[model samples]
Target: MAFTIPENLHPDLMPLAWLIGTWRGKGRGEYPNVPGFQFAQEVSFNHDGRAFLNYFSRSWIIDENDEIIRPAASEVGFWRVKENNVLEVLLAHNTGIAEGWVGVVKGAKIQLEMDQGYSSPSAKIVTAGSRLYGLVEGELFTSYDMAAQGQTLQAHLWSSLERQSEN
Candidate 1:
């Protein structure tokens, strides 16, 4: 099937088209004063000639050797460009927050602001957070800062990847 994006959307988003597929890679993450956890994820990016790239990610718990153990929860979202080069994303899941964000996109990097996310089904709340994404030398590099777990910034997940066949 042809993955060529339609011509009408903003051309600026074209560079990110390289990431428009399913990616499987190992990831390392950390929390406040704690050792990092290891996981593998499948991140899928899809677009239908719209203003956004549909996003979905599912992770797996891994063993010490970075081998898969079992399936984990996931995140579902939409990533798009807003007015004045602002990038925005909205994500939802059963285990995680329903999040909304605004940001900017650089060549291979993105800086985002987390505006709102669901604390719970009943307790809806807004959050303060920033996300950075860049492709360094070939690997995917990203960092997230959020107030969800007591207003802190941490290097939650990091990965160096090669584009492989989709899951």
Candidate 2:
């Protein structure tokens, strides 16, 4: 396919144009005392002259042999630039999740606050939080500062996504 960028993309968003493609990769995640899991993630970013970048993501659990075993949740979102020099993103996951964020976008990093929609089936709503994202050593990474359970800060779901040529 030929590379043709949209004319309306704000100059601030031009830096992210390179990321407007399909990316497949593997990553690892851990939660509390539960064991970590290896998974394959695919992300797609697109633009259509709107103020935001359309986004879609899907993931699957992979075994030691790197074979997919089951399907994971899927997410759709949008990334945009706000007037106050802040970057905003709207995301929704098929697993009953959605969020809107406003933040700052550095050269290769993004720091934003996140409002988790409804991920777990337990309650209609949960907590809220803020997070920071940095492209470290050419890898995407993130950390969270969430407020919930009458307790504040805690680090959760931090991972680096190394580009995979294919699934």
Candidate 3:
């Protein structure tokens, strides 16, 4: 499929043009002390002729039949691309956690490592985290590893999302 760059997008964000759209799919998540579960997710990225892209993601717990059970996680953030393909991200989650991440973009793939994080008094502290995003066979594939609640960094979630048609 051919992707056209949004006409007014900042030149710094050209490399990330492929991600400027909405994507939806299902994913599975598991962590120590938490029951494994399936979820449906929607992620969207958009730009406003600036150097950054706005990002938003929401997920809902789902049953074996792919029926929604309850709302899960949600987050909003911004992604900025700097010189040398350096990427910076700022994210705030519904769970009262805010994080800063840094990484580099290698073509269609990006790897991010947590740089800092803040947790509200009642939220769990995430000691470390890493995320990988890539385009695989035209689908967006994402994976996350996290260290939290006294556990070491390990796989926590993964999903493959197909781009949604522009309305």
Candidate 4:
């Protein structure tokens, strides 16, 4: 596949230009308090000539048949890369969780950690979390580590999603 950068991307979002596409793949989720499960997800990063990239993701828990059993998790967010390579992400989850993450961006790699996060009384408490994302050889790789439910930071989710669409 020919990968070309979108010419209409905002200058501030150039660092995140590679992520301006749809990615889909399968992943596994594991928590010490819950049974391990498989899931499928699609994530999109889009821009409207704005300084930041708009992000959205949807995931579903899948059965052995690769059929969706139920919605697993979803979030909407914005990504921005500032001077000095500081990367910032703001996300809100359907489960009443909102978070701010900050880190560094180098080439097509990003590493972000929770700068602040808040959860509703009914939402599960996630004290901290971190994520690493990179585009290598045309494949998107991502992993998540989180601290929640009284558990310390540990690997929670990971996915190797291929670029499915550039729109």
Candidate 5:
């Protein structure tokens, strides 16, 4: 579907208009400390005529039959965009980690590096992370790399999602 920038979007958000919608897709995850799993993910980016966009994501483990086997993870965050293309993203995870990212958005692509992170003593130490997001042929493509569990930065998650809501 053709995407039209929302008329009510703040001028500073024009560069991020492509991300304003709901998306759903499937993805695979693998890591050294955990067993690999297949998951169904849904992510949404929306704004209430405000200066920032509210972000939410949830994932569920699924079996071969595509039935949800168990809840996996969830996160809530805010993406703040400035007129100069500076971006600040703050996210809190159910795993007891909170991360703040700062970077720049160029056109439809975004690259963010972790600026600060805090975690509960019970949470795994996630010291740093970087994320990239872009739109390709109407699909939202996203990937993240992180340093955790004494492991160096490595691919942590990726997903390709189709738009599920109108522009």
Candidate 6:
């Protein structure tokens, strides 16, 4: 599909224009000492003619037949594009963790490395993380690796989502 840049989007965000929409898909996740599970996710990246995009994602644990079991994880964040295609992301999770990530956009893919994080008194601390996002065959593919609970960084979640709307 041909993509026309949003007329009011800031110049610096041109590289991220393709992500300005809602995406929905299913993903599987597993972590040490945690049961593996299937999940359905919806992610949205929207903007208000500003220099950054507003991000939100919510996931629901699903049963074997793709039935919704319960709400799982939710996060809200912002994506900013800086000089030389550097990307900065700030995210706050429902689990009481907030993180800062820095990365660079290379064409249709982005790789982010966790720079720092803060955890609430009752939250688990994440010592490190990495996230990859790419436009693959018109679908958005995402993978996240994290280190927490005394475990080293490893694959945590991955999903492929199709564009649902242009919003």
Each candidate structure's TM-score, on Cα atoms with residue i matched to residue i, is 0.80, 0.74, 0.97, 0.96, 0.94, 0.98
The sequence of per-residue lDDT tens digits that candidate 2 reaches over residues 1-167 is 22345567656567565456666667675545548787787777777766678878788988999899999757798888766558888877675656777787766677888744455665234367676756666554645565544554455455455543311
The runs of at least 3 residues in candidate 6 whose Cα sits more than 4 Å from the true structure, single-residue gaps closed, are none
What C-alpha lDDT values do all the predictions have? 0.68, 0.65, 0.94, 0.91, 0.88, 0.95
Please state the error at residue 98 of candidate 5 in Å: 0.8
Candidate 5 residue-wise lDDT at 167: 35
Q: Which ten residues in a row have the lowest lDDT in candidate 6?
A: 1-10
Tally clashes: model 6.
Answer: 0
Q: Tell me, what's the RMSD of every candidate?
A: 3.6, 4.0, 1.1, 1.0, 1.4, 0.9
**Tens digits of per-residue lDDT for model 1, 82-144:** 666688789887564687888887677888877776677554243566777776766556566
Candidate with the greatest lDDT versus the true structure: 6
* Model 4 clash tally, residue pairs: 0
lDDT of 5 at 98: 95
Rank candidates by TM-score, best first.
6, 3, 4, 5, 1, 2
Candidates 5 and 6, the one with greater TM-score: 6
The C-alpha stretches of model 4 lying farther than 4 A from their native spots are: none
Compute the lDDT of residue 74 as modeled in candidate 6: 99
Q: Rank the candidates by lDDT, best first.
A: 6, 3, 4, 5, 1, 2
**Against the hidden true structure, what lDDT does model 2 obtain?**
0.65
